[model samples]
Target: MTTPAPLRFRRNDWLELGLAALAEQGPAGLTIEALCRRAGKTKGSFYAHFPAIEAYLSALAGHWRETFTLRLMQEADRGEAPRDRLLALDRMALALDGRIEQGMRRLAQLDAGVAATCAAVDRERIAYLEKLHGESRCFAPAEARALARIEYAAFIGFQQLDLGLSPQELHDCYGTFMRLVYPPSFRSGPRV
Candidate 1:
């Protein structure tokens, strides 16, 4: 029998290490040399996986989108009430503390390619939210879309606030915002 090829580090392994580096030290600090050091690999390995730095960065964007989108969708599918699903998503996003999202957003501001990737991710996320809203029948389509926008904005805004607020305070604030933004049709009725 022919001998099998020895195990080799995959491109995803390098990309994951690069993403970790980006999270720790923003996009500006991300360099191939640093990434290679972190991954304990050589420049040749990086080159073998990606054509160039830009290609690596693009791959990073795709990785982030896939990771974030999957988490959100998984939470959304957890059989909770519609409103609860949205709140769970808000909590999950907050839990991330916006590190990866902030890194991607900053990169987008500086690079057109990154910007396009970020936009595509946003569009995909919004479409997913729209579908959830429709299936839940929690609110009219327009209202659901509007609430989705509000939730997204609030989550991002709180990240930018960087006020070091306690988690309880953040949850309370989110609850209040949800009450205001969600239509009555979407809310649970008063407890008896």
Candidate 2:
């Protein structure tokens, strides 16, 4: 039989490979050489998708923001109620690759574009959380805002902690926080 054609990676394929590299090897792993090796492709393949390293990095950040933050928010919004939305968001967030988020945070320190992307993601996430909390009617506008910040802070902190904490443990901790901080009516709703 004739040999099959060589695999060609598309733009999104390169982006996805970059995310896996980040999760496995951190920011340093994002080098063109590293990524090409991981994909078993050449520099030409990468250049076809990205003009330069800076552009590739920006694209990678955008990819991360789209996949991790925006997509999750959209999916969570599909829930029928605010509490259901919150729980769905929590489950989705917890299921994400924390290592990739940690790598993005690490990259943010060195890249202004990445930093801005991270900041935007943080703002978007908090705003979504605030909206969900307000819709739940468990807290006033200000309280919802504050609670959203607190919740987002916990998520960021938990991702960066890298203390071998499993997602289930994080989810349980979040459930506990919800029980303790949420109103009695909500306390019952957020139970794990």
Candidate 3:
């Protein structure tokens, strides 16, 4: 099979290559040699930026956190209303790169550093959801927190577990989930 075409790699280029490698083959596939081949570079180039594989992995996790989690959270917070915000979150969830998500999650299982970072990401997302549910629904804090946990769990399960869903189907499922979790007042009609 034809490999990725030849390309020049710069400082951030390694991070891009790491992400693509993580997406395609999980963390196990991210190596200096593999990335060098994929980017048509050399060990000299890789070492120029990363002193060792651990450093590269650290950078990879940081890149994913900045690009994916933080960006998605910003996108989801753009709306004024709770429904709008939650839908924005659903849209972001639906748009996540499952391959990268799965790869990172698997890495978390085997690597302590990755696991801590992944846990932090999860905690941030769950906290955001919890606050949204608590504020919008005015549920008891415990109930709202539970709802948030459920929502995030479902998102992780759907994406990482290889649930067979066409894009449209997953979209519908997420929409349905959001609707189900909406506050009763919000669901009936206009916000009360």
Candidate 4:
């Protein structure tokens, strides 16, 4: 039988593959050969999109930056009430790709470019979180700022923790963590 036409992998196709590789194998392991193998394509296809590995990595980080930060900001902007926004933020935070986040943090530790990108993303997340904290109506400005820092750290730490939980179980865990960190006034909602 005649061979089928080669699959057409576009720029986004490469970026998505690269993002997966970033999560699974860190930046140092993001070789063009590995990407090509994972994508089931030849080097030609990869070169068609990115001139080099650095460009591909940059595009992958940019894609994550755009989507990840936007999800937080968009979620934080929802729900007029501070508690509602907090809930939205919590849900978004829990739903994030933990593997990619961990991989990014690991890469950020060694690479200045990745470090800067991670810093910017952290700032964005903290800024949105601070706004929600300000509206929380329980803490003064300095207290809110301090609480937000701790809250964001807890968010990151929880993601790294291997609870081996199913979705509902993790949701329960989030609820428990929220109660520990937030005052009773802000702890309205399911106790589970």
In TM-score terms, which candidate is top?
2
Estimate candidate 4's alpha-carbon lDDT, on a 0 to 1 scale: 0.76
lDDT tens digits, residue span 23-142, model 4: 777765578887777878889988988988777767777778877787677866867888787787777766777888888788778767777888889888787778788887777888
Q: Give the backbone clash total of model 1.
A: 0
| Lowest summed lDDT window (length 10), candidate 1 | 1-10
Steric collisions counted per model: 0, 0, 0, 0
- As for candidate 3, its clashing pairs are none
Candidate 2 residue lDDT tens string, 3-64: 12248688998898889888888999988988888888889999999999899999999999
| Whole-model lDDT values for every prediction | 0.72, 0.88, 0.79, 0.76
* TM-scores, one per candidate: 0.81, 0.93, 0.89, 0.83
Rank the candidate models, highest TM-score first. 2, 3, 4, 1
Q: After TM-score superposition, what is the CA distance of residue 31 in candidate 1 from its true location, in Å?
A: 1.4
Question: What tens digits encode model 1's per-residue C-alpha lDDT throughout 1-192?
Answer: 111222566887876675667677788656888776666667897799899999988888888877777767787679567666766776676566467788888888877888998898877777767766766776788977876666666766776677888777787887787677566677675311
* TM-score, prediction 4: 0.83
Q: Which candidate tops lDDT?
A: 2
The predictions' CA RMSDs to the true structure, in order, are: 6.0, 3.5, 2.9, 3.8
Please give, for residues 1-192, the per-residue lDDT of candidate 3 as tens digits. 114643656667788777778888887778778888777777988898889988888888888887778887788778887667777777777777788988998887878888889999999889988988886856799998999899889888888666688767887887677567665666665321
| CA lDDT for candidate 2 | 0.88
lDDT of 1: 0.72
What pairs collide in candidate 1?
none
Q: What TM-score would candidate 3 get against the native?
A: 0.89
Model 4 pairs in collision = none
lDDT of 3: 0.79
Which residue pairs overlap in candidate 2's backbone? none
